[model samples]
Target chain A: MRSGYYKETIVEHINLTDSTLQRAWIGIGLLLVIAAPFHFEFYGLSLITLMMITAIGAMGLNVLTGWTGLISLGQTAFMVLGAYAYAISTESWGWPPLLGFVLAGIVPAIASVIVGVPSLRLTGLYLAITTLASAFIVNHLVLEFDGLTNGSSGIFVNRPVIFGYAFDTDAKFYYLTAGFGILTILACLNLRRSRIGRALIAIRDNDNAARVMGIDLRAYKLYAFVASSFIVGISGALYGIFLSFVTVDGFPFLLAIEALAILIVGGMGSIAGAILGAVFLVGLPEVTSFVFSWMGSSAQSLLSTSAHEIKGLLYGLIIILFLRLQPHGLMGLWQDARRTWTLWPLKY
Target chain B: MNYLAELLASGLAVGAVYGLIAMSFAIIYKSTGLLNFAQGEMGMIIAYVAWSISTSVDGNPFIVALGSIGFAVLFALAVERIVIRPMMSEPILSQIMVTIGLSVIFRSAIILIWDGLPHNMAIASGNQLVDLGGVRVRAAQIAVLVALFAAIAGMWAFFRYSRFGVAMRAVASDDATAQLMGVSSGKVQMAAWAAAAVLSGVAGVLFAIAYELSPSLYALGLKAFPATILGGLDAVIGSAVGGLIIGVTENLVGGYISSGLKEVAGFVIIILILMVRPYGLFGEKRIERL
Candidate 1:
């Protein structure tokens, strides 16, 4: 027990030092923000924008799954709520884009609290299934509320205007997404340092133990859901602004599963993991298609239709492999590599 | 009255398919304590296999049905061996994720092999309308009801009389104790998955008669999730009953109210039911050991 406690402190120390490394990451991110638009075209910028939005959503999922020990398949459902809310408030009610965005985040966060309250009593896979049901309900609600959501035709979202400055082009939107992405990262970083964050982790480690220690289970769990869903909701609103369209078809349970996959592949609790996982999972198809097209016309022709299938196969394989061999995900691998590099002279 | 009877008959028919799929879910959950998200996909894929077999045999429905179940058992055993067995010691979350990943793979594979277009499965009765006094029901619907009852009765008898079934129950209750008692937990897990696959396969074939076969048929598998959840994740009888409730609710809502409510009704019931009974109807109340 003494050794176990010592080991945990050592891990904690490593994380503290890791934050210093995160400063360097911030510098790199700023550099990318300044440099990416110049280097890449519209498609590339749009993809990066998408990746950033996904990263924010993945972070939200990480908060629930990684920190609070709650597995939610309803991340995309919250996102859809945010997206549709953004579209409706901005278009139908003639609300300002900024207010619409704020409404989007608040609405889904409240929904999350409602959904989390009753279901939090259940643990593990049961909670996961409940969340899955929530996603289905979200999809159904999108279809059923045809008057508001416009049914299958969906709604068109205009570019978000910030004090008369419009984020019209893909590059401009990429900057907006990047700004939000950085804010999400910093907010999450700050959250982890706060007492509430510590409480969340403690509950994650053992809910009953945390409860014994005088922590309110219901409040903290709802906090986690609200906080996470708030972030996911913002990402969804931005996603709508970026795409300039919203469709019921756009937010399938498949998309939710992919978000969960990002969390798992990124390293559940790590901030950097969310970004890395999102980029890798989102960019994989584009990269695969690029490589395939480069191979020759024949290969591309054969795989044109089946490219999605191949991507699914590879993604599934990666999930299984990561779970079996590297449960810490890509972020874990990065830490391991950093450790090895730091210990190079000593050679183990 | 005639419309009501027709609706009831059709609802029971579809509910039987859901029951079959839900039973598969219950069996796997009972034995392994993990829900197979890929069960529906496996069923759909196996139905396609059945379709191929039927076509090869000049449309012999019996041979196709038998072959499909056989192939499904083999596929399930392979899945258990290759993907599931290695991760036996992992967390429940990891196992669940693996199944979800497996589901994606299976869905994509079906798409790859057969493309995304729907296929017509030759129903044994060929859309024949059977007169049940004043109310007319499709022969395929009757076949589905019969198949559901047969499957349930067969499962009951197997659990009651068969040595393997008894061994499986032992393993499910306590794997370590069952292993000590000389029952191979591995084989039991395999059999449980196989039984689920066979049941799902039969459901898939019957479903194909009612609805077109397509990659999207995995959605039907997802449709069974609420059934298992509502019934009790591990109770076979409860799952069957839960399926009937969901099936009938969907039909009644679709028929009587707005048709758009059909798909959403089951989910609404699930949320409402879970709010009241978290463990679900007929589920064993878990005593948390603090």
Candidate 2:
């Protein structure tokens, strides 16, 4: 009898209540955005902005790995390209910084096509290795073309200015990133609703079946790589703006892995997952360190030295646990809870 | 001419070390169909163990080496049971991610314990160099190459003769068929992981003698990946040959072209090779039935 009631509630929720629930969730998000930043001061605000930027990066990865089923470890390389493009255009070529941001996305998209064309034929882990190799090659190339990239010392990025208003302060940059972050989420949602997105999903589920359905495998695969990389590149430009500098050392294999982790933890195929993952991963460490500091001076000192090591350990454990038990990640867990809540008053 | 000879000698030695790790990778991949991304960190951990054992035992290199390999086998078996056994039925991507996670954990654990300091093995080789027709080479380098060849030859003989080895081969060829014939897939996979870890352990100890021990040594695991790919992930003998090919090309490029290209050359070559042969040179062709 409980199972029957549970089934009825699930059926009713899916058939009748999805739109209402979605609107309620959207309202919560709007309220949080308006009220949340005012609660935190400068450092916390900056961290949240950083989370937003990384969320953009994670969402870009989701479009490829989660939605389209292409595993790439080269997101950092694309971001590096975006950063360098922004720096070179704005600082070296004397272009407006705003225009440089646009070029940041465009340039890496072109490079993604070059890298993706040959490697996409190989399946599974083989493609992953190819992308990883491309990242190393690109890293070397960045170092080699020192004349354009200013070599290993890195390039200083000018503060983003919009019609005489400079986003130089943390608060100003917070709004700047928040605006872009919302735009990225909206753009991602729009993309998932588009024909191309459906085709990408079709290709991911079954390539042969998708081909039978007249979806061009090569075109869509390349499109996924290029499109996702473009968003990642834009985030990269924003990353440079946040740091006020771009360097080769800033992007490494670890950064790529971190982005991949964020995608997995956020619930790969959803925009909300990306943002939630960004918050969890980025915020958890900060909270941990704060707790450690409250213990004493010695613990604080130890934390300073081994903070990153601890973070790596945590990230590894989380990946293992989530993959083993909750492969759908935090977003999936949220979905399960929502289902259960909707079925309240029935024990099942 | 002498410069060329010395470069070849050095390159061959490094290649030999890479060959050891590649073979290690091929071992696990053959039976389990999963790439152990943590292969290098496993090696580094074992090397640290070997170093510790050497210091405690008054620097007896042979005993330390043997002890390290023993520890590695045990560690690998434990890891297979705890981490990988649960993931046996998971997607290939999730399995790979688990390995990546394992690598991260191992690396960080090493840093936490060892404090990221570089330690010299100070092994018995003692920087000894020999002159062959006026081209100098380290005695340790010669030992490395000889040991690599001997290990490969021993592996070939074992696979052809040993009962457990043949069972592993059977399982690799067809898991269900082998199971029907009374072979345990779990045991075979455990043995494969143990063997792979042992090989990596030996490679790590040898590597520490040539270079200082540091946490960053795990990067070699990534470097050896190309060798595994170039030869075929499941081809044991191909790994040795692939390792040598990558090793020689890297040296030649670094010697003749800018040294900067050496690191990038392996990847570039692998990409080109993969483009032409999607399954690698010696990889078994996978036929998908849709």
Candidate 3:
């Protein structure tokens, strides 16, 4: 076997010993994701697509809450705004579908700035409550502007026709969402290494110290908010397209909580953790149903009827348990497992 | 004029319930420095327990109330010990998230046990209208107001004169200093949670009597945030006054403006207040050091 420290160059030393192996794993994962539709049924395929969409939003949330240390309970509000923006622009304003998607992001980003500017001064729990209030206000506005949002009855949306190619089929839509999701992941990875990203992390760790170090707290916080909401808005657009209908009820307060759960369960401040969390949480209900199907009919019936509550309870328990036991989350667990495997037959 | 008078009378009663819940929130924030997101859910669960007790005890209000308060204290103590105590050393974010987790669990558990239907409680003076100077009010409303005053008075006396209460205040200001002076911050935090639970339990039962007990009752808990924020996160009496303000404002807005605006009136007020005074009307300004 080759010795671990065989590298002569500084660049080689900086890179992981298993960098090529890691790249190969990533390649295989991508291939599997691309081939998922062929291997799985329609239901399973749709679930995977939904997971990718959720990952996009969760990643956006990670940028704010994870990286910047800002707590937002209004993420759903931005998603709602994005969904409505896409729906209204394409349906009423007669904008092109692609352009509507762009607007979807822009609208919520603007709203985020409006909300962020006033509330970014407040930190921690105070900021959290402010975001929540904004969410209520957004929901109320969506309902009040019946002329634009079509009121509580909701608005119908058609699949996008990009460059004369229609994304009509579920499989076709899966590819569209997957493309965006991969792009989001790449962007987040780059961001974590970028100067702005470092500044954000510093601010999160200690804002006063960051301020002393010449970081513009207000501008960077706004940038974090804008970047976060923009991606979430795009995801919202995808979610609206996936459902082909958008309603106020579609984005509930629970959605925000679920996003927070995704971050905590995955691993805060880790991009890959966001995706893992999305997969685990999105697939959770299906897993529960499969298990419940094996139980007695009466028990299964009871569970099915109260499935929403059961899911909520599980999410709550998971958040609490993860924080109490494994604060670093599934990513930390994965790292420990990998270390164990790499050190097989050695006590170390 | 008559309609306005009726609205004001009912608003004050509803405000009293809000005040009680706000007090509960303030109590925890004052002593522990942790905003309890599960405050409303605590009230909701206690109310449900009280309802069950009422049904089993042949609708005796006194027994139901006492049992509910006892249950609330034990439940709060258990929560403090189990969910919160372990998290005491964790970051503020973790503490907040834990309470949110507790909220989700409590809300879901309530739904799982009680179902989603609204239940009418026969514990309080049920729907008996009392005409006061041409203004019609429910007897339950009057009882809620009385409870609110009694609670505020009791809290004032306890905080002002009691030894333990002074210890809690001492811990709140400086936990380290309090520890040096022989006050156990841990015990004080536990007492704060228990006190909050009792206040929430009473408020929940009173609210259920005034309105009706339902799964949606927990939403009222969220509304109390505005009250607490308005009065000041750590101001007990200020939060009570804030609740009254929020309650009356909500009524006037609902009565005069579109009913939709009523739901968000408190939020709007708090937002404006935050812009002007981040600490709140009655809250002390906290100066941070680098």
Q: Highest lDDT among the candidates is held by which one?
A: 3
For model 3, which pairs clash? none
Model 1: runs farther than 4 Å from truth? A1-22, A344-348, B287-290
Q: Candidate 1's error at A91, in angstroms?
A: 1.9
**Cα lDDT of model 1 by residue, B7-38, tens digit:** 77778888888888999999998888888888
> lDDT order of candidates, best first?
3, 2, 1
**Each prediction's Cα lDDT score?**
0.84, 0.85, 0.90
Q: What would the per-residue lDDT of candidate 2 be over residues B210-269, giving only the tens digit for each residue?
A: 767888889878878888888888888788778878888889889999899998888897
Off by over 4 Å in 3: A1-18, A341-348, B287-290
* Segments in model 2 whose C-alpha atoms lie over 4 Å from true places: A1-21, A35-37, A345-348, B287-290
Model 1 DockQ, alpha carbons vs. true complex: 0.62
Candidate 1 lDDT at B91 equals 78
- Order of all candidates by TM-score, from best down to worst? 3, 2, 1
Checking candidate 1 for backbone clashes, the offending pairs are none
Interface RMSD of predicted model 1? 2.3
iRMS per model, in Å, is: 2.3, 2.3, 2.1
1 against 3, candidate with superior TM-score = 3
Per-model TM against the reference:
0.95, 0.95, 0.96
